[model samples]
Target: MIGVLVTFTQNEKFDRSTLAGIASELRGPFEGMAGLRFKSFMLDEDGVQARNFYVWDDEEKGRSFFTKELVDKVTGVYGVPPTIEYLDIVGFVDNSGT
Candidate 1:
């Protein structure tokens, strides 16, 4: 498996409504994405940064979605260019259903 983390940093914390809007706009595009196992939207405790963590079946699957347009969109939304990192998923633990 592959893990991709795309992070955006903003000068200030995003308000609840802004965060909701971001999720609303993005949920459709991410849902059922090719080779994607799941996606998690994350926020830093300090509230200055946000990230999207995506788990994919492979590297090709992870790369297939994070395009230039997506980068531009993220920048437009957060007012900062995102930092993207890709890593191998050495292991995972899921207990959501427990």
Candidate 2:
């Protein structure tokens, strides 16, 4: 499995609520996306940051999804660039349905 962390910092020109709205609007597109296990949209209103965490079943898919084009596109949307980090997920625990 692979985990990706994408963070967008708030800037003078951008509001976090706009990003949150975008996330809400795009949630359905990601719901049944192939190779995507889960995605979480997070915001730190006090800290002035937006973070998104994605868990993917396929590492290649996870890595390939974050392309330069994607970064640029999101930068345009947020009015600031994002910092992306990729992790090799060794294990996890889930009890949501249990």
Residue 92's lDDT in candidate 2: 84
lDDT of 1 by residue, 1-98 (tens): 99999998889886656866788887997787778888988788888888888999978879877899989988998778999999889999878879
Supply candidate 1's per-residue lDDT for 9: 84
lDDT for model 1: 0.85
Q: Model 2: per-residue lDDT, tens digit, 1-98?
A: 99999988865434656866988887998989999999998877565778889999999999999999999998887767999999999998878779
lDDT of each: 0.85, 0.86
Give the range of the ten consecutive residues with the poorest summed lDDT in model 1. 14-23
Query: Which stretches in model 1 have alpha-carbon errors above 4 Å?
Result: none
Clashing pairs in 1: none
